[model samples]
Target: MAAPHDVPSAAQLVAAVRDFLADDVLPAVEGRVRFHTRVAINVLGMVEREIELGPAQAAEHERRLAGLGVADDAELAAAVREGRFDDSALVEALRDAVGAKLEVANPGYLGDG
Candidate 1:
């Protein structure tokens, strides 16, 4: 008995479809609509993912900064508005804030790190 090869693999079909969409369909489309649509869809997907995870991430960051005994939210907010954290302690505070955010919000989301 021999294995049949009538069907294409999913990866092969997807690649073929993408190539067709890009080289044939997209080029035939008028104006910047297609280009903008593609960008908008991509950005919307990213925003959706961020919205789902941003809050927990922010909370974790706040907790870490609080642990570091850094300045309160009002102070951080003011510094951010002024476009600088300035001091080394402040920088470390920001680092810890971000690290904790990533750690909790996406722990294991980074893959083996």
Candidate 2:
């Protein structure tokens, strides 16, 4: 006997299946490879997202700062790497970069909503 809230929804079941594909299926195929393969895959996915979004975000920051006219690519790159950009600029940059990169869409990212 379970409460209504305790029941797993269809979305949760689907999510569990998706997690299994990533955490179990992919790693299992590597055969004798250690768990580090899965770990590496996960890390690589994160890096890919960063690469896709990071530049566009920086470009947006540069665009916004077109008003202040203090934007430079080299300085922006340095700031991004060192994480020293102004707060608003950083947020805008990240949003733009992520939006741009996300356009291509990754297959591994299994979600519709």
Candidate 3:
């Protein structure tokens, strides 16, 4: 969907800052500052990915929750803890949800390499 705003949308702005920090500011920092800068860069990356994927992921999550007859993740967790559902389908659905989250959080972590 086209952003209902001008150029340099939220994701673009975040990407710009993240790139600036990584390519310029990061190299100049040391010790704790460098560590914190790295952390900030990671956070900005997550924010950018979230901006790109959050809506679709949220819709899919709601659909998956409905499929499992649960209103939300907390209820799903409760059902799982109580052994109310146990099946391959359930496992796959839960895995898919986790994978979607990983995509936003850190896609590299899911890489085969």
Candidate 4:
């Protein structure tokens, strides 16, 4: 998608700030400032991941929900609680959906880093 405004689109601007916080601000800060900087950096990282993966994740989530005979996560959860489907495939699909979420939220948890 072409940016009609100018150079440095929103994602670019976010990336720049995130990088600055990680590379410069983080190094100089201490105690609460450092902790908050880390949190801010993580939030920025999640934002970047969502910007990159949110659409694909949404489509995959919908597809997985349909495969499990549910329209959304709530329905899926209800079905799971009710034991409507007892199959490894359902479990695997749910696992994959969660894995996708973790990938966006914290990829390091899966040792992706």
Q: Report the number of the highest-lDDT candidate.
A: 3
Winner of 1 and 2 under lDDT: 1
Which pairs of residues collide in model 4? none
TM-score of each: 0.41, 0.31, 0.90, 0.88
Clashing pairs in 1: none
TM-score of 1: 0.41
Q: Which stretches of candidate 3 lie over 4 Å from their true place?
A: 1-4
Checking candidate 2 for backbone clashes, the offending pairs are 53-97, 57-93, 57-97
| Model 1 lDDT per residue over 69-107, tens place | 555777667766776655776677776665655553454
Misplaced by over 4 Å in model 1 are 1-31, 70-74, 77-113
What order do you get sorting by lDDT, best first?
A: 3, 4, 1, 2
The predictions' CA RMSDs to the true structure, in order, are 11.8, 12.7, 1.7, 2.1
Clashing pairs in 3: none
Task: Give lDDT for model 4.
Answer: 0.87
Q: Looking at model 1, how many pairs of residues clash?
A: 0
| lDDT of all predictions | 0.59, 0.57, 0.93, 0.87
Better model by TM-score, 1 or 3?
3
lDDT of 2 at 37: 56
- Residue-level lDDT tens digits of model 4 in 1-113: 35476776666777888999999999999999999999999999899888778888999889988888899888887988898996897888978988999989999888833
User: Which candidate tops TM-score?
Assistant: 3
